[model samples]
Target: MPKSKNKFGKYLLIFWGLFITPFLLLIIIMFMASKGWIGEQLPSFEELENPKSNLASEVISSDQNVLGKYYVENRTNIHYYDLSQNVVNALKATEDIRFEDHSGIDPKGLLRAVFRAGKAGGGSTITQQLAKNLFHEKPDTKTERVIQKLQEWIIAIQLERRYTKEEIIAMYLNTVEFSSNAYGIKSASRTYFNQTPDSLSVQEAAVLIGMLQAPTRFNPARNPDRALARRNIVLSQMNKYDFISDEHIDSIIALPIELNFQVEDHNFGLATYFRESLRNDLLKWCKEHINNATGKPYNLYTDGLKIYTTIDSRMQRYAEEAMREHMTEIQKKFTEHWKNKEPWEDHREILEEGKKRSDRYIRMKAAGASTKQIDSAFAAKTKMQLFSWKGDIDTIISPMDSIKYFKKMLQLGFMSMEPQSGYIRAWVGGNDYRYFQYDHVKEGKRQVGSTFKPFLYTLAMQEGYSPCYKIPNIRVTFDLPTGDQWSPVNADGKYGGMLTLKEGLAESVNAISAYLMKQFGPQAMIEIARKMGITSPIDPVPAICLGTPDVSVFEMVGAYSTFANKGVWTQPIYLTRIEDKNGNILQEFVPRKVEAISEETAYLMLSLMQGVVQFGTGGRLRGQYKLGMPIAGKTGTTQNQSDGWFMGITPELVSGCWVGCEDRLVHFRTLELGQGARTAMPIWALYMQKLYADKSLNLYKGDFEAPKDPLNVILDCDKYVQPGDNKTSFDRDF
Candidate 1:
């Protein structure tokens, strides 16, 4: 009996040992998993900060004063909202109805997913999708996929512990890629339909949610049929789960998956030209700053930055409309002319063919066509077949087509700024931004023509030349340093022998400007121009007075802005401030000012410029457009009419307009068949008319004071004395 009892005890002990051994092994496995020795571990917050991690802080618009995007009104991103109840409900019903109730793994969903993968191939859960987007490296394999699943499970549990179910859903919506270049629901909505996420209809929301399965395959923009099919599946799922009423699900499914299909206006209010100019300027400034620091090229586009710009949306639209209307009129006229002659095909087609022929001829010349050969070619029968037969033969010889072509060429850009505050108010960079990206307003460097005369006048004034002092506008040739005798002529080609300093400037007399340069000495004029914000190097030559220097519209605009701002010059600035995601200011732009001219001198100069608008070449603008304030401006035409320019100012705004080809070739038509005032000025005037429609905004004018220096007064008189005038008041001193 004792032996039988001992046998029973041994059997009992062995069975107990078997049960306890399995529990011990299970504990060891769980500990190993927790320690990440046997499987992938969950990512901690510190792991997210690892240098090798692909994740980076998201960039947001730095504009604080404006809500949402600075330009777009009433548009808000998903990031701005803190997990709205509707959003959470929508996502839960659409993505995973059992998400909150399940552990890291959903058993029924997993089993179903495995069966679907075996049949229709790949399937992923929300955790798996998040792992793919946030953590998994590419070039995927079975091993990598397995590891990813393990990591996802671990991370999903960690996420569940750290964040509420609503927060996880919010982050998922924000991070998921819905379509090409559309990383979040907000961007996806904007890119596909030009609507905000919150504004999305039930149908639209379902379509976006449907994209979760296969974004590219179900992209409504690309595959409408597939998108609709996927959307119906989501609607059915919502109905099956009782998340939405059966009637509502049926109604949603029956509704057409009609997309608004409104594209985002990347141009931003017809200011594409201005945007391009601003972009180029910003790029250049960024590059220069980077080069100075690191001696290497830096691409501003890739750098995460907030670039504030100087464009006024209202002014920009007005400028674009004016330019388009005027140019379209010209284009219509040309088209009509071509149609009247051809009568068989589209006039634009004929014009295009003619352009090609002209281009070939130019190429031939560049490739080495001798003068005699070119003349012979022009006289040949083959030339008629190739060039003259194409379109209006007169277009080659007359400036009409050239003018129309340059206007159509749309190379000109105009920019205006408030010199005192460096506030850029108006900009017209190109006729169309789609065709031409080079912004003449900021990047183009063309000869200033006679518009630069003011600098010479300013120098003469600083040296004691008064506006009332008379000077000779007679035909005179000067022996240049290069031994070439340079003879300057007036706009009308007739010398007005003796004229007051005011008349000389008002008339834009080239001879008078040249004479002033010689009298004041080129070095002094250079100094004055430099001081007034003309950064382009000026040649110390007599022709410099006649505006021989090549200056950018930006430089000229800034210089004129000084004259507008009571002689205080401020650097043109675009950005106001930059801030990080936490609202910490990274950079702030402060307006920098320098005294370019005395307030008295600036007022006097402005008075003379007003005469230019009232009586000179720019006077035509007054007749065409009613400017409600005291206006000062200058009109400039280069030699051979290659460049046409107008720089004008009111007390409130300073603007510069330039019209010319990229090449220095003469190509434009004028009212007098001679100047830019007739062609470019009309464009400028049209833009300004729309700009100043608000009567509340008027020019700021104040009292002017004369200089106190006796020597300055004497010098002003001496420098401005007209030729043949024997009023030698200072002769005794000499």
Candidate 2:
């Protein structure tokens, strides 16, 4: 053999041993790992097709306003097209400029990273990062990490083959975390800048992209200086990539990171109480309902449902505003009324009950703490925030004292609905949902007081009683089943001559209501009330005439809407429909309507109740506020001024309000300041004024509709109050 041939053959053998053998071995190992022949298992075809991620469910208003969300990860998915051009450009430039050009892994970038010791850039593509995000778990050892890295590479390759470039980008944006518990670009945009993904500006998009490197370190809200530096780096990359202009880069880089940072919370936003109240039904729905494609029940916190409600955002705003305006005044008045005295002084049992329900007490009790130890813990002064009319008051207080303080805090419930359709427009359940988790509009049951009278009067009207039917305004006594004498008193203790049913209903005369209650009995009243949508338990007692039953604002509003809907009782409905994240309709809802009385009876009731706003207790709505919109309303104050209430009905709407301290004994001592006119009417009045002012709502500006076929009952009491056939047909038991 020749000497030159020998030398070439030796060199080729060395090259083959050093490079080709190891490369082939590596290729074999990677293939085995991809097939799960090694330590870790790769995702199967089914998992690759539909990766699992927690997507938040949204509550949407009738106006399409997002009220709030329910979530496990606070993640929401948006279409790839929903992304702003600036966001995509900034992300690609900063994270992986060769993103679109590469398949799954960047070979050139890997070579550069290896040769340069990773000083220049990372070798991982956006698809690889997305792969890591999907299946990432903390590996204890370095060997496991190596296996995981290989698994990620294989998954990234699979992903690239499955999804388009735009889809991969969208998936990455939707899967990654942007800190503050916000996962996905949609939530990140809102959390950082209060903007949607499509509305994000170049500066905002850069700030969000910058957070991906070190979510907490570069968070614009937490670390503004680091965020600013990181944001400018993204802008520079955009400039280098020619994605943004020189002029645009200069202006954007000069601007500081401006953030409208608000962390997603259940307690923050409009209709917080309503959102919380609706959560129960939603959870039940998620458990009961099935998604046909998945063959499993929907997860309310993860299924990404869109709940469409009938709530008008403008009307809800007005209702909240009115409560804030009037409730503030009443809170001050309540404080003055109980000056130099504690509202809970006579009701110490309430304090003990509250103490038992407290977190500290419950925790200590669970840990086998003695009563003395629990008491000592409660007496210890601690820093906490207390809810007040002004704002959350930060104070150093003992738990015992804080309980007492909260006991004095008066609460409120208010609601409004369309009478004919029973669509609940506005709902305010409590003073503040964060501090008081109880929902007074739906969950709470308090003495409805004289708001209960309408059911009796409606029943009487259904039983062929005239608006001009005369009844003696004398004390009517009842013999109870317990052999006790029960006689209810009026707010004003004056009972004299005969008063027509219209006059009695207008003035809310208890005597006339009692006379009618004695005729029909409480069970008959309850039957009518049930048909009208009152679901609370009522005692079968004649004393119920004086409004003795405990009921919710929700029940009262639904029941009263029966009259305004022309005797067609329409049950209140809030949810209109539910849809999936993909905009597929899942479920639809409709309100229940039933004919409770004749149209003539409804019109007559409307005419009788109108006299209340014209001259009686609720007259302040017209006389003081000068609403003058042909409103029919009733004011109610329970015994000892424990609960104050107002129910207002117009042609279009039926709304009710109730105000009281949490405990029945925690109330105004005198009836003057605690009457519903002073406590609850102003809220309704202010709310209606705002609604009327909007001109968009077009509410409460019309009169109640009369009967289609007129004159089964006489509403013109001035001409019909003669002493003829309309005189007392039934003898009183007095």
Candidate 3:
């Protein structure tokens, strides 16, 4: 009996040893991991102070509006103060309920997760999740997962020791990826709601908090039903935790998820073309200028440089609004006129041009794709998003057919600038940036038509010609350097009499323009235009007087602004300054100025252009908009009614606009529907009407300043008698 008792005792002792030995070994391994003795090297204190996350550089408007950002992660850090209480409560209720009670690792939650196989709740606290987000990459294997879990625990404890709960939460929100290229709460808020985090309501906060689980699966814009259900679940959790009242939950849940989805992509935001152009400028600036902290060139993708531009948000809005308003009506008229006829003169040529411009064509060419395959791809119908006057629509269409549709659609470019300072105030590059990547305001070069006549008239004034300078309004033959006879006829086809330069220009008599060009010569005119900021290559030809040279709206506005600035031409300045992330000034931009023409000559030219708005083709400014300001402008119509241009100037502002199809071959059949007065002038009038109404804009409504010295030009024809007539001829030229 003694031997049997000893054996039983030995068996019991062995059983106790077997159970306790493995538990002791597990404790030792965990302790080693906690002290950085196991797995990968953890982030040190210095690393924790400055986390490795991509920061976006911002483009801010002059009015302090955040235009957009350039980033790899699309992340912008916000302080704890920027977060609303509702967002905090929603995050706490959905992510970690006992967040305030835990010291980073919640033992109670861990045991609960173990009992329920992670179905009831997650064991990792906010700090642990933040630790995983900040310090560790996602593990691939089961063994790697175990090691990562140990690392998370250690890092969570370190985080608890280093920062407060609020700071940890803000840091967590700032570092977590919300999918769709959005990183951090600030970016997520802007991406989903088009508003800041501080402006988020309880329902909005709940929606964002719910997205934390699976951003792609529950994206509010894409999956409204799933997003709504998840948001309601978050709301219920908040209600159960007393974060919100039951009555509030009931009311909030009833409301549908409203998403103002404005994509902040490179081609989606306001002034997208302008922003794209500015990015190139910044890229060059960064390469030239070195960062103070790193002693290296700034990376626009990573460095949080703040680009302060001269664009006014209000004026930009007005410009876009006016374009949409007038272009829609103008397009309707054009479509009606071409109901039976094909819009393009050479559809095949336009299609080939469009195919050359396509990315697929370029890539396929690079990859050595066969001609048949390329043609098949272009002809095949595929899903696409198309821009309409109403709104964007999704449809299935062939790429070639889409290009044809775009060619039929009339597009426009409008830009406004300060005459004196050269600051570009408003820029509308095209009808839509997504559909049209070509920036007409800066890149497009179409025939200026009668708009170029003003430059010739400016040359005339410099050569001692006046507003009252009489010229024959008859067909004139110019002996060209090419040894060809160049004779121009009037648009009205009525020639034979004398008219003042002002009357000829106002009526846009083509014969008079050619006669003046014959007399003054194109070389002198090109020199004056060059000094006035026309950067395009102008040919010294007789036909150039009839506005044959193709010029961009950017160059036209710069030249027109010279007249507005009392003859001092200042090159258009887009960027005002660039500051580093730490508010250190890196560079400041100044206007490039040159004396293009005399003050008296510029004012005399203004006197001639004012005749156009008052009594000639641009009378729509007075008839339609009733803008009674001291406004001077010109209307242009290229041959075959391809391009329509309007350049309007006031005491403070000068705006230039162009309206036409993507391809010059596609145009209205007649002057009734295709004239500059009908197409581009209305956009200028509408934009100016909006500008005049907005008192905050402070745009001068007064007339152009007269020359400081008395000019020997006849500006008003109220009492002047013609040199050959006994009675003053009151008959207008047109």
Error of 3 at 343 (Å): 5.2
Candidate 3 yields a Cα-based lDDT of: 0.86
Colliding residue pairs in candidate 2:
none
Write one digit per residue (lDDT tens) for candidate 1, span 5-101: 9999999986676556446644765686778764654455754332121111222222222211322111222443543343455566765667777
Name the weakest run of 10 consecutive residues (lDDT summed) in model 1.
50-59
Q: What global local distance difference test value does model 2 have?
A: 0.86
TM-scores of the models, in the order given:
0.72, 0.93, 0.87
**Which residue segments of model 3 deviate by more than 4 Å?**
1-40, 97-119, 157-165, 222-226, 246-256, 291-296, 343-348, 356-386, 392-400, 707-714, 718-734
Predicted candidate 2 versus true structure: per-residue lDDT over 1-734, tens digit per residue: 68999999999886565556436646966687667676257787888988878899999988888889999999999879999999999989988889888888876776666556668786789999999998778789988776776777778989999999999999999998999989999999989888999999988999899899999999887888999999999999999999888878788789977789999889988999999989999999889989875899998998889999999889999999999999888888887877778776766799999999988888999999999999998999999999888888999999999998888888999999999999999999998888899999999999988888888988888777787777888988888888898887766899989898878988888888989888989999888888888888888888787788999999899988988887899989999999997899989999877898778778877887898888788888877787978788888989888999999998889999999988888888888888888888899999988888887766656677777675655556655634455555332111
Which sections of candidate 2 miss by over 4 Å? 1-26, 33-35, 38-40, 721-734
**Relative to the true structure, how large is the alpha-carbon lDDT of every model?**
0.63, 0.86, 0.86
TM-score quality measure for candidate 1: 0.72
| Of candidates 3 and 1, the better by lDDT | 3
lDDT of 1 at 693: 79
Q: What is candidate 1's CA lDDT for residue 20?
A: 67
Candidate 1 deviates by what RMSD? 10.0
